[model samples]
Target: MQETLACFKAYDVRGQVPEQLNEDIVRRIGRAYAEAIRPGNVVVGHDIRLTSESLKQALIDGLREQGVDVTDIGLCGTEEIYFATAHLGVGGGIVVTASHNPKDYNGLKFVREASKPISGDSGLREIQHLAERNVFEATAKRGGYQTADLLGDYVAHLLSYVDITSLKPLRIVCNAGNGGAGRVIDALEPHLPFTFITQNHEADGHFPNGVPNPLLVENRSPTTALLQSSNADFGIAWDGDFDRCFFFDAAGNFIEGYYIVGLLAGAFIEKNGPQRVVHDPRLTWNTIAVVEGAGGEAVQSKTGHAFIKEKMREADAIYGGEMSAHHYFRDFAYCDSGMIPWLLVAELMAQRNQSLAEMIAARAAMFPCSGEINRKVEDPRALMRAVEAYYAQGCTHIAHVDGLSIEFDDWRFNLRSSNTEPVVRLNVETRGDVEKMKQKTEELLRFIDG
Candidate 1:
């Protein structure tokens, strides 16, 4: 067995198939996870990837070998598995998905009861060690496997999060990117008044067009063009496994996730009446401004699903968001979902009688950002230290919540290393000054590249 750090990410197991991750490794992970959690019953689900079924079966075999009963939810998204785990009140759950990675890639995401994420600090490191060691004490009797379809309950739970009955007729374009999101939309469209112009709605493991990741500029074109041509109110797209979602306005412009964060924060605040909201430190001015303006509290947290979920539970926040399109909800046990954001956004539009662009236009000018920029560097920590040293001299405030973040009266920026990739992500925002934001972003990029 080869020892590689790539499979051990901050949150879940992920790697290129048959190299860092394969059937043998996945089976071992299943056994190890079963032993670690020692759940009497475990729920498992898979995406549309070709390898998903095989990997899931191997995992189930390992779990059963350890006398852990397995409940299989076939061909579901990550959030569905989370729903199954919580709704069924099971011991824990695992999702068999690489989540927006290439088809040749596959991985697993584990959670304890109520879909609580498993991290390195929690139980992931132990699982990794066990998986690498490839040794486990066998049980006297093997566990049994049972199949269940929880899609109905999952869909109902999602709809209950938003008031669709009061929504007006709104035309929207949905680009599933040919992933697992299409089925959920199909089930919900009949129950709502909104008209959906769907594209790439098929669930294809090959991802016929490209990977489902909306962060890539190239992936936004199809959804943008479809929204423009259809003159839809707005458009939404999801990555593979449909955990995170992105939105596009009626003008076919891709709205930054930060703006959506503010929108969702405001919506939740209006309904829930000024509660706490959690946001990642990388991009937070808009979120903070919105939450504070609405008489709510804005709590900053480190970037990652596990950290955000933990913060949400601790703060009892109504909602939380990361700039990378991951939105977490208190109602969903602090689990991120690709399906819920748009539902609430649509409801906000219907209730306000305004278009999505109109609602976000005012906030857009309050804080213009250069979007996240990534740089491949040799020493991420050294570069971050240098940037912090440069900015700390004159900045009014600085923080190391996740990485280096410096805040001046008029501008602020955060530079952090990726947990799963060999790169550093830099995000800079200025108080409605595009030129300054651009200049500072360039300066930081140069420093990182140097």
Candidate 2:
């Protein structure tokens, strides 16, 4: 058997199919998870990957073999599994999905009660060790599986988050990119007062257009073109498993998730009145400014889903956002969702009577940013240390929250290595000076490459 610890990632279990993440490994993980958490009942869901069903069945068999009751929520998104776990008050949950990876890749995301994520520190290491040893002690009494359709309740809960009754009947374009978002939107459209123009809405495992990751400029073109042709109020797209969603303006301009983070933070503060908000350190100025201006506390965290969720719980933050498009909520057990951000943004637009572009554009000039750039590097940490040394002498502010972040009088930049890939991610922002931002970005790139 392939070692399971090699496949266990910072936030979830993911690897190449059949080799690193086969049926036996998934089954072992399920049994290990059951034993570790020892929940009376566990909720299970799977995405639209080709191998998802088989892997899910293997996991379920393992759980049942260990005498743990399983509540199967078949054909659901990642967030839906979170909802099922939190709503049912189960001991924990597991979602079978590779989440925007190629069709051949598949993985699992495990969570404890209340849909809390299991990171390397939070019980995942224990599960990994157990699975690696294949030492799950099965109970003599076998457990049974039960089926429940929680989609209706899930939709109702999402609807309750927004004032749908007061929403305007705006024309919106949604590109599911042939993922699992189509089913949820199909159920949601009937309940809301909005016109939806959907493209690639079919849930196809083949993923004809790509993996549906809207972060890539190439993957966003279809959704932008659809928005332009339809002249819709906005366009939304999701990743393969519909865990994180992205947005486009009425004029087919793709808005950065950082801007949306500020927008959502402002909205939440407006309603809830000056609560704490958690933001990752990859990009921080915009979120910090918005949260502080709204009379809310801005807490900076390391860049990862598990870290963000833990910080949210600790600070009791009303919301948390990552520039990578992950948005977590206090009400949603601090789990990220692809569906919730759009709904909240739509409701905000309806309530404010402003275009999505207009509202987000107001902050664009205030916090000009170079966005995020990734580069292949041989020595990421050495490069980061070199940059830090270069700036530490003259820098007024510096932090190593996730990676290296340095601040001068007029400009700030963050250079961090990706946990999953061997690439250094760079994000630079200036005090409304585009030229300075570009110059600093170029200078930093040259230094790193040199």
Candidate 3:
């Protein structure tokens, strides 16, 4: 109990197991969640983490004891709980997962009705307070529990995003990083025409292939190498909870997620009507141009799933995409799905008769960018101010949606401090000049490191 349960983060709860997080702490959190939300029924699921089972059990124990009926979907990704929560008309849901953190770490993510996230600004803080208090009223009656299989319905929902039969039989590389995504891929295999060349395709809680985060350049190696060796069409890699997915093209080149935002925006705009598309401000010129060019309205929102989901719901947007590889769908109750983006991309390739590389190359050339660069600093806020002040001399445009985005003659960059880390994130892009983009990025890096 001495360990600071600083486990509750800005977006979700994540901490080292048994110390900051354990069965006892999770039990309180579960009870606190039930007490705060007061749902009659709730859905729960867990990822392939070592402590996930015990943590999930503890959470269920608290909920059941508090007279909240629990429907458990064992050993699944985060999105499955989201789907089941909204689809089943449950009061709320919780998924026990660390989501790409180190093996020694574990956490929980919760959602209210319709699978909407219960972020700190919403309800997570109240739950955290109640849990930290460590006191709860005992319920006289205990609720029932049941195990439900949602794989079939979830798979059908995924397949419904595109015309599966019309998709070409392309050999694609898939690296699940030994996370919970492998099973879902296996389930979808029989229904698709394409052949999957899978790697680390097992449910190993130990994370034998390292943490299942493709965002790290090191983690991209397995998929990139396999894509080249197998001569596959394209490849994808997912994080532990399988909520964020990254992509590699035919030549095994890692595709910056910024471009994928534009790609996904186009597909959603063309398929669903000319509707609002929410985008984060880190790297938005590409997304805005692509969305508006396709007759869809592009709206800017602060980064993070909770913010993006709230904006999408308010705008009634058909789709919302973050340059960080999170894509949200209105049909999915405004929740981000790691599975839908790839499916839509595959279908777009088939319908447009264009290779993944070729289709995106033109857009990439138009908006050459420095994919989010992070820097550790003694004082991140001071660094952001210094960087912004130095660059604002002759800036043509500026925005402060998520951070500081300043534009000049032909280049623009955003420098923002991380909410969770003592680091500053920088993103620079030029209007078609790679050299200019590189120069600006280097200059900004010097300022950030100073």
Candidate 4:
């Protein structure tokens, strides 16, 4: 029998549960992964989603059938799987998570040795095709399965990224949105000097407050409200799997992820001295300026974790950041992490004797950006082409790195269509001209709508 795996996305497997992604389909995927990559030992973990456990077990069954040993790091965030894959020297790893998707959706993210991503052009396509064919050779010996607790080691590693003694006794607000991040926070609380005001700190699969996506404006209210009322230094929030983290200042303002990228880039250069940093093309001006000013090289890559990580390795970049809140570290085998960014930011604040707002305000003012605006169109490709044609004149530069990025002397914009939907995403920035940035954003939207 053959099946069409609609859950297989360009980067990983994601779909609505039970229908598009169920235990049977996941089992087939596991067998396919084992056959395609032929990893002898694999690490697996799951998020707080209700169906993740069962699906993980089904996947393990498939791996075992193909004689692949499994190490179940039960109930962990996606980064933990990445860490364990590289730390424990496993052949590969997978995490069962939908990562801020709605209640009924679940998925899997895969990585090969050294925590390298297995995306479309990588081994993912082969796995998808093999799973669709649904044929696997039976092995004489079944693989072993065991559980490991690497929390202490993981937390220690997280702490290694920052100088703990340099961190001040700052009060920070952390909202996990009832996801896996809170667990890691709890583990790190005893080790750090800062006081953590935690919200929705428990791991709840039901997600009563809603899906744990900090990108949604509504999801941020709880964290921002708590931060303002409690007089905390700053606030941080995470999505379901806690892979990407969002930041809020003491004034209860959501710091745009673009500025954070520049901040992190500068932090890396300040610490490591003129190293390369990777950034997505969606928003580039501020990052380039910050990197060059700090005597570092700024490298641009297509907007995705796989691409960023691959580019980081090629350039031996010390750090990589995307405006979507994903922060990648070279020390972590070039994988993205939600926990590391906040810690580094805290250390940066302490070292500079500044607040989070104080550090970001200068850069945000220098590069005012129209945070990614999305519009659904009947044909996103056509809309992209139309936007490109409309803006081609008076543009000093144009590139289709990940999308249609058009640049002028004082302002620039990147317009790209979504991979999975008929929606186009637009991002605009200017050379410290907020009004111009706003005007151009509105103009681009009107054109896109037309």
Give all TM-scores, in the order shown.
0.97, 0.98, 0.98, 0.99
Question: Which stretches of candidate 1 lie above 4 Å from their native place?
Answer: 1-6
What's the true lDDT of residue 16 in model 1?
Answer: 84
For model 3, residues 220-309, the per-residue Cα lDDT tens digits are 877888988998889999998898889899989999999998998888888777989999999988999999999999999999999999
lDDT of candidate model 1 versus the reference: 0.90
How many residue pairs clash in all the candidates, one count each?
A: 0, 0, 0, 0
- How does residue 146 of candidate 2 score in lDDT? 94
lDDT of 2 by residue, 1-93 (tens): 735456888878998899889898889998888888888789998999889999999999988988999999999999999999999999889
Winner of 1 and 3 under lDDT? 3
Q: Residue 197 in candidate 3 has what lDDT?
A: 95
lDDT tens per residue, model 1, 123-185: 999888887788898799999889998888888999998777789898889999889999999
TM-score for model 3?
0.98
Compare the candidates by TM-score and give the number of the best one.
4
lDDT, candidate 4, 179-210, per-residue tens: 99999999999989989999999989899999
Ranking the candidates on TM-score from highest down gives 4, 3, 2, 1
Which regions of candidate 4 are displaced past 4 Å?
Answer: none
State the C-alpha lDDT per candidate.
Answer: 0.90, 0.90, 0.91, 0.94
lDDT for residue 63 in candidate 4, whole number 0-100: 93
Clashes of 4: 0
